[model samples]
Target: MTSSDRSPILPASAAAPRSDSEVERLHDLILSSLDDDQADEVVSIPLAGKSTIADYLVIATGRSTRHVASMANKLAQKIKSETGQLVRIEGLATADWVLIDAGDVIVHLFRAEVRSFYNLERMWGFGDNTDSTN
Candidate 1:
C-alpha cells in the first residue's frame, strides 16, 4: 500500500495537513541519522489537546540506544537549520527515547524495543483523513 492508502493515525477534531516534502525531509533525516529495525512504522500523532508545546507529534524509532540519540540529534539539527525552528530534546542521555519539540511539531525518537513497548500509534487513532503522499 502507498501513503495514499494509509490514514494519518490521528483523531477527527485535531487533524491538519502538512507538506509532503517536509514529511519526506523528516523521514530522510531520521533514516539517515539513525539505524533501526523498523523506521517506516513511524507515526506522527496530532496533539492539539495533548500538548501545549506543539501542534503535532512525530514518532520514529532507532535500532538501538545509541542510534536513538544520533537520529534525534540529526533530526533536531535538520529542523533547526532548515526551518529555524526552536527545539527542545528530552531523554537523549540514555537513548531509550528522545523527544524533539518544535512548536508546530514534536518528534519522538526511540529505540526499537522501547518503541514497541510503548505502542504510541494507538494513542492517536485516525479519524477520516487518509495519509496521502501528495
Candidate 2:
C-alpha cells in the first residue's frame, strides 16, 4: 500500500509531537536498549520523510516467544522510566510479534520466522541511514 493508503499500526499519541532532536534521542534510546537485550538482526529504518505514523521504524528479532515478550516488556519499561513517555504495546500475548509505539519511534520485536514472514525491512525500502546491530 502507498504511504497514504497505509494505516498506522498503532494509534498515535494525542500528546504534542516531539522535536527532531527529541525524536533522535528516543530512537537512540531504543537502539541501545535492544542492543543491551541481545536482540538479533536488529535493523532501524528511517521513516521521517516517508510516513507520518512514526519518525523511525525499528525491527529486531528474538530467539523465541519468551525472548520477544521479555524484550517488549523491558523496552516499554525503559522508555517510560527514561523518557517519561508511556508507550503503547500490542501482540504481547502471542509474543510471535510485538509492536511498541514510543511516540516518534515504532519498534517491532519478533521471532526470526515471524520477522522473515513479514519482511518489514524490504517493505519499507530500507537503506538510507538504516543501522543494524547483529
Candidate 3:
C-alpha cells in the first residue's frame, strides 16, 4: 500500500501535515547511523498517524552499555548537525537504555538484554517479524 492510502492515526487537531522529505531524511539518517554503529535488531515503525509523539519510532540493540551510550551520543550529534535541531536524550547515565527524542523521530538504544526485557517493539505493536532494514 502507498502512503496516501494510510490514514492519519491522530485526531485532526493533533495531527498536521509535515514535510514528508524532512521526516524521511531524518528517518534515513537514524537508520543508517544505527547500522553503521553495528546496532542489532534495528526496527523502524511508522507512527505518523498512529502516534503524535513522533513521525517514526526507531528501536535498536547495542552490544553493550558502552555501545548503547556511544550510539546515542553519535545519533544526537548527527541529528543536530544534519537538521540543526537539538535532540533530547535520556537514560544515558545508566547506559542500559538510551532514549533520543529527535523532532521527527524517537530513537531507543538499548543493550541486547535490556531491549529484550522491555520489548518496546511488541509494546508498540510491531512484532519481531517487522524488520524494515532496507
lDDT of 3 at 93: 97
30-93: candidate 3 lDDT, tens digit per residue: 9999998999889888877778778888999989899999999998888879876777788999
**Can you rank all candidates by lDDT, best first?**
2, 3, 1
Which residue runs does candidate 1 get wrong by more than 4 Å?
1-40, 47-53, 126-134
Cα lDDT tens digits, model 1, 11-114, are 32233444656645654554444333344456656555666545556677677787777777777777667765546778988989887755456677777788
Error of 2 at 111 (Å): 0.4
Candidates' RMSD to native:
13.0, 7.5, 10.0
Give the per-residue lDDT digits (tens) of candidate 2, residues 29-120: 99999999999999888887898888889999999999999999999999989888888999999999999988789899999999999999
Clashing pairs in 1: 10-126, 36-63
TM per model?
0.60, 0.86, 0.82
Model 3: per-residue Cα lDDT at residue 48:
70
Please state the error at residue 68 of candidate 2 in Å: 0.4
